[model samples]
Target: MSSSTQVSGTGVVAPPDSTGISIIVVGGGFGGLSCAIECKRKGHSVVVLERVPGLHIQGDVISFGPNAGRIIQRWGLHDKIWELCRHVDKLVLHNYLGEIVREQPLPLPLWGAWGYDGHRAEMHQVIYEYAVSLGIDVRFGYTVQEYYEDDAGSKAGVRVEAKGEVVSMEADLVVAADGVKSKARKYILGYDDKPRSSGYAVYRAWFNGQEQGVDTDPLTDYLTKGEDAFFGWIGRDVHFLASSAKGGKEISWVITRKNDFEVTDNWSFPGKMEDVLAVVDGWEPRCAATLAKAPSCIDWKLIIHDPLPTWISKSARVVLIGDAAHPFLPTSMQGGSQAIEDGVVLAVALQLAGKDNLPLAVQAWEKIRYLRVRESQLIGEDVRNRWHRCQPGDRGPMLDVPRPEWLFAFDAEVNAYEVFESVARDIRENGYNRPVLPPELAP
Candidate 1:
């Protein structure tokens, strides 16, 4: 079949006769940019709209497990990521007293072995640059306010508020890659259920690796000092995670707590070095001393959303992806990775559908993506809650509930499709069914 074909009755313009689909991805973060690039690779036109001025969404450090690392490698971003990422070689869990509690070596044998590295900024830059190089029309500072759809509920477009004007643009498909607190999601939800704040606050900071000198023997004793691994000092209600980043040029510090104050989901706020210091004042001298030299900090509040009824909206000609679809806590570190996976699968599904059925392809997309993404969000929250319980003397005996292998072992491109196909088959079998879990489960 050619890339695109006009139906006998409908007049909607499709992808090029030689291309499979045309898509607009809202949000230029890792996931959005990746989807745009993958779609272009599959012979489709893509446009990325971002509210931020630049692609750099600031954060201290992020880890990509072996599964996610593979996608990063496949995207031709391995080299660039490695240049900026600190290769953590172990997984060290510690008690609030700065004592090593558990240690596991990083399983991957090669640095970029399976296509994973750990730099937030580096990964963002690579995806952003690659998307542009591939001809994705990334329009920055474009705030997408709403989505509008045709009467058929098959075609859709996004309404944007940019530069003192409202602009609406149409597309064969509309992807809401917007972050949590997404405006597009409201249209997809068709109801009002806002994201809830978890009352958790985190202070993030970065320091020069050489100046901080965190590799000293005493620090390594309890810190789980290695490549790719991180050390955490877990307390009753607060904890700190310290990891290496920027290829060892910098050390990333994070302090999280269930503070009573309502925290906003802002990641760029200037963190007070002294405020963070107050938390660990009595910790081991070595850990305290090292953190004292921290150069800068960023503040972020933890926000969470309940599981949505479904991420696809027939009336809005829009669907949610990435955080816009399912926002997870930072503890899972799978947020960015999952979005990257979504991009890849979205591109593949669109290509396979043939442009004659663009709307059908998007429906297939929601069927393929919703469950896996939903499961991921739940898993992240579970981990955060469990890890949050490991502070001080409250450290429970080795957790009886083992980690879900499916969560980390997942290969989005390979495994996510299986889930998607099932949903599509069910949809076909059930006749355009929309999932309705009990009211208690609806977001």
Candidate 2:
């Protein structure tokens, strides 16, 4: 057993003996890349495989709560991330007619840390650069086709197709972070369980403030006042969320409404400006004016599957993380935050378990995460339902304002360390036991 601390991108040294297990993380998105970084910090040799040929910068803006911000700070990307993101100061809710429903202040020391609103592309670039700087092997343009485990079930790996060539790579553990439509998911469940439609679809658009004629006005002035803000308009079966990003240089909004059509699970679709306006036709002039200036938009169908029975494979050498393990509604505002948590906890568990107990580490990761993820998914569902069902007179608990402290103040790395011994002991003595929420985070 060697003991040496590896230097990370932040110039901070990780714990002693941080290297041993070889891990292959599939998908290279938020979850995969973050996991690779954490694993590398733990002294594990990690390889990240992304199917795309280049950087994936398709989506618009995303929010990261304090839960993720703390991890970013730990990883030494706090300053860089703050530079790329806008700190949200407040959230205002309005009815269809643009009447104020409520206002919530996101003061400093919010949930133990400030929140961020930024472009997804910028966030991805920051993480990608950090991963490369740390020497984590990242291979792009490789699509995974199959997953396999050794006959003895001690090792798991994947077979991928890169360009015209098929390649097989083996690792001590395989982590599938391949998004909601994961190919590795079927292998874990022994069958395909496609994501089900949430009966809702979102039309999203992002554009430069100047090009989009996004001048400050009484209706939209709240967004351009230096501090970041989220302005929402709620209507029967429809809602719109608008905010600024890239330091107010860009404006982005999403219109979510009940959909009856059976749409594909793709993240985006070219949408006409007329159609985008139609969704919010009777709501407010500011909403129309803001969206009409956008040159283009993408229509995304929201879909979700049931809670997976388990994230670990039968061999226990392979496991799922992030969306591959649990998918959440955009309403949750936790999609990226939860994925970040997954990576940290998984790495901590693997580090504590050491190489010989890889199976136990994987099981422990799933046991610790499943219930918490389910709780978030359910909260997302509840919030989505309330937002869509809200009418002129009724609006439920406004968007988890001041977000539950339990959700934001959690430190995955610390929690994993605190629970690893007990979790491993339970797994050793009684197989896998369903884990309960740490009393601090429990509702």
Candidate 3:
């Protein structure tokens, strides 16, 4: 196949490119898929390995701010994705007492970013299928047990199960988009830093509103009665969020509160409705009325790791992207968006650096991303802390989520093309620069 050829009948119109590097991407989620797609679109040969047996659309609401929306638009998946999204019209904030705090209109123009927020599985499938359509090689049920690279050998690879036996697959570069509990950390960091609690947990649930009786119940029908609705109620130390999507066909809800569950190696466990009711007891009556209909929820404990020293390994042939490299607090809703950004920027980096400068491309990509990701991660912590300490006067400005242009308005693909040269040159002369943390974050 020609480097610039578009897969027939798909109308993918992958942007023209000539990088021609063979890349192996680990994980098939948003980050991994984005990496594979962007790389292929840029004319790189890419393979994606996912441990899961098959594609599963099983997660609730996921958002893609305009920064990432721009990337999706380039891929020709925007309109298709919007069709499957909830199309939230506004965000209505409420106090625990049921009094309205603020009802803000949706899609704030942070520079023409029509951020899509909808079922996680739905958004993921749009990207996943698009990658497959482009003739990219994506293998599922192929669990990667280890990642390895040889700068001296000029290659990187992952060992995975194939035909009932482990096989070694090699490429010019290997990407670990593996999740938060990534084993790749040991290889990249030399030591795995354990994840500590962020002192919070969320009970998440999603179900058919009609089936769950929420759409018909007099106390809760308002949630599903009209256009996609998003509601949030913040209390002393807890916050409850609920929404109607799929045009009232589905209902989703979550409650983030102080974590009372004992910390353990595993941070996710089953949630009890009684516990949910207990925590949300004083919230608006409709809040409990809606929650009582939930079949069940997952108690997910938010965990954090110290700022990583590097996302690239010594070989520079292997690197970590997405959750594996920098897991975000839920408050930083950009976790998924930034992961997609990493994929886009990485492809641009490799393309511009060319095949011979793999080391510089890999390391410099990390330097280019570190500070932006760190600052975005900090937003979550700042917002969560303020929400926890919610005060009488804080309901207006403090509760409103900031949608800044510097963050939401970014176009990773174009930015990479513009800045890669300067950033890469800086790395060559001075070395890959890592930012120093604020005194409060520094240990």
Candidate 4:
């Protein structure tokens, strides 16, 4: 396959040869799918390989801020996403006694739009549908066994084990969007850094409010009766968050507390309702009542790793995206959102650099994205600490602070195109280097 022709400045380049630069995306989760869609939209031939046979619906809900919403709108998926999402109006913080401590209204104008809350599975399905519509190939039940870059370093690809047979596929570029436990990360970096436990585990449950026999108490009413709202309770070393989804047809809650015993980092572990109720024991009547009615619960251990030294390989033909590149805490609410941003920026960088300069493009992608992701991860850590250590007397700004507009107003696609040349040129002149603080993240 021939490299795509380069177009200088802000113009979109025409697709290269009939077989545009081939890109193999490993993993079919939100990040992988989003990257595939963006790359395909840029006229690249793309394929997604997944280890699982079908959609992994382990996570219950996800929050998409305006940064992610902009990309969704660009992909013409806003209507579809809106259908599955509930617009969050306010976030209400309560004490252990269930008394309202602070109510913070979501900054709609600053956010560029209302924040969206929806099931992770539904969002995944929507992106999958869009990818299929674009004729992008998505293969399931194919596990990547190894990654390799051609001897000349002009191309890269992966070896996969599919249907009990080993298949070797080569592409001009390889995007590893595999989740937190990324195999490609190990292959590219030549070592593995085990994820460290955050000393916290979350018990989550989702069900219909009415069917669960949850009485319409003030707490429940505040959460489900009006415009979308998020209710949270902060205790010594634990926190509870509840919100409605799909127009209050469904409600989900997660109880995150210090973990004292050994627990795997998996997302689905059968949790005893009695254990969950006991955790929130003397807290609030409504909180206990809500937990008592939950049909089932899953315990997910929270684990985190240090910022990766780099997200690109020496060959640069193979690169990591999404969780494979940067992982985040659940509190960040930016896990999926950051992944979406990564995909868009990567695609735009590729488009601007053209196929012949793929390595430079990948470098540009990393330069523009690294600090932003790191900042968000740190923010997540900060939020987690504040929520866990918050005392009963703490109120208002102590519990919640207004987030910076830059976090929500960013358009990754536009930003990437605007800065691609300078970033790529810098990489070519001097090897890729980290910024003390990227301008985007500067206070």
lDDT of each: 0.67, 0.80, 0.82, 0.80
Q: Which has the higher lDDT value, candidate number 3 or candidate number 4?
A: 3
Residue 57 in model 1: shift from native, Å?
6.3
Q: What would the per-residue lDDT of candidate 3 be over residues 1-443, giving only the tens digit for each residue?
A: 76466431122334433565889898998889998998887777899999899998676777778888888877888788887777776789888888888777666434865688788898898898899898898999988898888648599988888669999999999999998988888888888678778878888888888888887789888778766788988888888888888787788888889885565779888888898899878777988998898888888898888788888888788889999998887777788999999998898788778889988998778878888888888877877877778875566665876677799888777778778889888888988655566666552
Rank by lDDT, highest first.
3, 2, 4, 1
Candidate 4 lDDT, 1-443, residue by residue in tens:
33455432222434533336789999998899999888877767789999998876767878777788778877778888887876676788888987888898776535554456788888889999999997889999999999999889998988999999999999989999999988888877789767777788889987777786443655466556655657888887888888876666677888998885553445458889888988998897778766666799888887777677788888888889888888888888889989988888887787767788888888889889988898877777778899888876888877774366788887777788788888888888888774456554443
**CA-only RMSD, every prediction:** 5.4, 3.6, 3.3, 3.8
In model 2, residue pairs whose N, Cα or C atoms come closer than 3 Å (at least 3 residues apart or on different chains), thus clashing, are 18-42, 18-43, 19-43
Q: How many residue pairs clash in each candidate?
A: 11, 3, 0, 0
Give the best candidate by lDDT.
Answer: 3
Candidate 4 accuracy as lDDT: 0.80
Q: How far out, in Å, is residue 331 in model 4?
A: 0.7
* lDDT (tens digit, per residue) of candidate 1 on 1-443: 44354421111223432473557889887778878877776667888989987666576566565556666666667777767766665656667665777665554533334424455776677767877776669998899888878887666888887888998888878888887778887787778667677778788776666665555546532332343345666666676777765444567777887765553445347777787777777775655655665766676777777777677776525778888877877776678878877877777666656667665566777666666666666655566677777644444335222234665666666654455557556656776655554443344
Clashing residue pairs for model 4 = none
Candidate 2 global TM-score: 0.92
lDDT of 2 by residue, 1-443 (tens): 23353333222346433557899999898899999989988778889999999996778877778888888877778788787776666677888898887676676556566566678899889999999998888999999999999999988989999989999999999999999888888999899887777888889887777666565555555566655557888888888888876556678888888876664657567888888888888877888877776778888888888777778888888888898888878888888888988998888888888899888998888888877787766767677777777766764355444477778887777788889889889999998754455544343
Name the top TM-score candidate. Answer: 3
